[model samples]
Target: MTTQELLDQIRHKRSFLCVGLDVDLRKIPGHLLEEEDPIFAFNKAIIDATHHVAVAYKPNIAFYEAYGIKGWEALRKTIDYLNKNHPDIFTIADAKRGDIGNTSAMYARAFFEDLGFDSVTVAPYMGKDSVEPFLEFEDKHTILLALTSNQGAFDFQTKDSEGRELYKRVLETSREWKNSKNLMYVAGATKAEYLTDIRKIIPDSFLLVPGVGAQGGSLEDVCKYGMTKDIGLLVNSARGIIYASNGKDFASAAREEAEKLQAGMNAIMRQNI
Candidate 1:
């Protein structure tokens, strides 16, 4: 989806919520395992229950990859379901894929062409060449990992080199690549303080923010600094919403949790406008 289309959805839904489908067989209700494809079954119910409250859906690729071919089938079915039923909802293949230029291009085709995801999370450690191949696709987004919301982020992302943090330099240098306008950065909600400086660098680019809800990052703190005129944030909640309950009422409970976040996002959006 284009930036304008995404912003319009936020206005229409009064939400900037991105529900993360980080599904694990162990964590999901035991009853779902009775189904042929437990992962897709869980995802379908969650999507149906919370579609109105969420503007985006992100399925982390690792969850499916761990299950091998069967898991991949589930991922494809999930994406197909979303595309057929709710095409407007921005779909992300949360595959942190980055490699040599040729391989990167193939990964781009797999997600964007074959699976039909609107965006894919990419690792930028290999620099612009590795990431630019993903950007080559018109209107498709490459969400580069910037300041992540992990304990290990401090190890490399914050390392001082030439008096600037590594992530800061990554953000600055990414802008010089071709089709950078289609780029978004992954700024973890745990790194909310850095949003101020991040906004200074690329104020208009959208940010796919994880680390809220289960990760304990505050939604209010994220919007306080990360938000722009277009509502430049997609705050994700995986475990908090999807795993709200382990019983049969899981879908209902997930809706309730999503509603809570959507309501908060609506308030922030109102204040911004």
Candidate 2:
């Protein structure tokens, strides 16, 4: 999806919530295990219950990859279902992939063309060449990892180097790469305090923020520092929403959790206007 399309969705939905479908089969309702494909079954229910409350859906690749071939098939089917059923909802392959140029280009095609994801998260540690290949695709987004929510992120991301924080340098340098206009960043919600500095470097770029809810990051703090004129934020909640209930009513519980976040987003948008 294009930036304009994403902005329009957020405006229309009165939300910027991105639901992470990190569905684990082992934790899903035991009844769903009887379904032919349990992971997709859980995802379908959650999507059905909460589609209107979120602007995006992100499926972390590891959750499926760990289960091997069956997991991958389920991921494909789940994405295809969303594309056909709710094309307006932005879809992200939270794969966090980046490699040499040739390999990155292939990874880009796998997600954007084969899987039909609207965007893919990419790791930027390898620098511009590793990322430019993914950015080549028009309208599809490459969300580069900037300040992550993990505790270990402090080891390098915030460390001073030549008087510049590593992440600050990343935001500054990435702008010069090919098709950087299509760039969005992964700025963890836990790094709320850094959003002010991050905004100074890329004031208008969209940020895909994780680490809310279960991670204990404050939604209010993220909006305060990270929000832009375009409402440039996609705050994600994974375990907090999808794992809210392990019973047959899990989908309903997920919807309730999503609705709470959506309501908060609506109020923030209103206040910003």
Candidate 3:
């Protein structure tokens, strides 16, 4: 989907919430295992329940990859279901992949062409060559990892290099790449304070933030510094929403959690208006 289309959905839904479909079989309700594909079954239920309030869904690739072929099949089914049933909802393959130019192009084809994801998360350690290949696909986004929420982020992302932080350099340097407008970024919600500087660097670029709820990131603080005139933020809540309940009411519980976040987003947007 185009960025404008995504922004339109956010406005219509009164939300910028990205529901993380990081499904863990062990954590899901035992009853779902009785189904043909437990992973897809759980995802379908959650998406059906929460699609109204959520503008995006991100399925972390590791979770499916761990299950091998069956996992991949489940992922395929999940994405296909979303495309057929709720194409308006943006889908993100949270596969933090980056490699040589040739290799990255294949990965891009896998997600953008074969799997049909709207975007994929990419690592920038290999520099411009690794990322530009993904950027070549028109209308498909390459979300680069910037300041992450994990504690290890301080070891490099915030450290000074010639008087500039590495994450800041990543943001500034990425803009010069070809088709950089197709780029979005991953900024951990746990480091909300850094968003002030991050916004100053790339105020218009969308950020896929994943650290709220389970990781203790404040929704208010993130928007206070990170929000743009277009509301360029996709705050994700995985465990906090999807695992809200592992009982028979799991989907309903998930919807309740999503509604809470969407309501919070609606209030924030109203303030901005």
TM-score, one value per model: 0.99, 0.98, 0.99
Q: What are the per-model numbers of colliding residue pairs?
A: 0, 0, 0
Sorted on lDDT, best first, the list reads: 3, 1, 2
lDDT of 2 by residue, 1-273 (tens): 889999999999999999999988778889999999999988999999999988999999999999999999999989999999999999999999999999999999999999999999999899999999999999999999999999989999889856998988899999999899989999998879999999999999999999999988999999999999899999999999999999878989999999999999899899995
In candidate 1, the residue pairs with backbone N, CA or C atoms under 3 Å apart (3 or more residues apart, or in different chains) clash, namely none
Q: State the lDDT of candidate 1 residue by residue for 232-257, as single tens digits.
A: 99999999999999999999999999
The C-alpha lDDT values of all candidates are 0.94, 0.94, 0.96
The top-ranked prediction according to lDDT is 3
Question: Where is model 3 more than 4 Å wrong at Cα?
Answer: none
How far residue 15's Cα lies from its native spot in candidate 2, in Å, is 0.3
List RMSD in Å for every model shown: 0.8, 0.8, 0.7
Error of 1 at 70 (Å): 0.9
Candidate 3 residue lDDT tens string, 106-149: 99999999999999999999999999999999889999999999
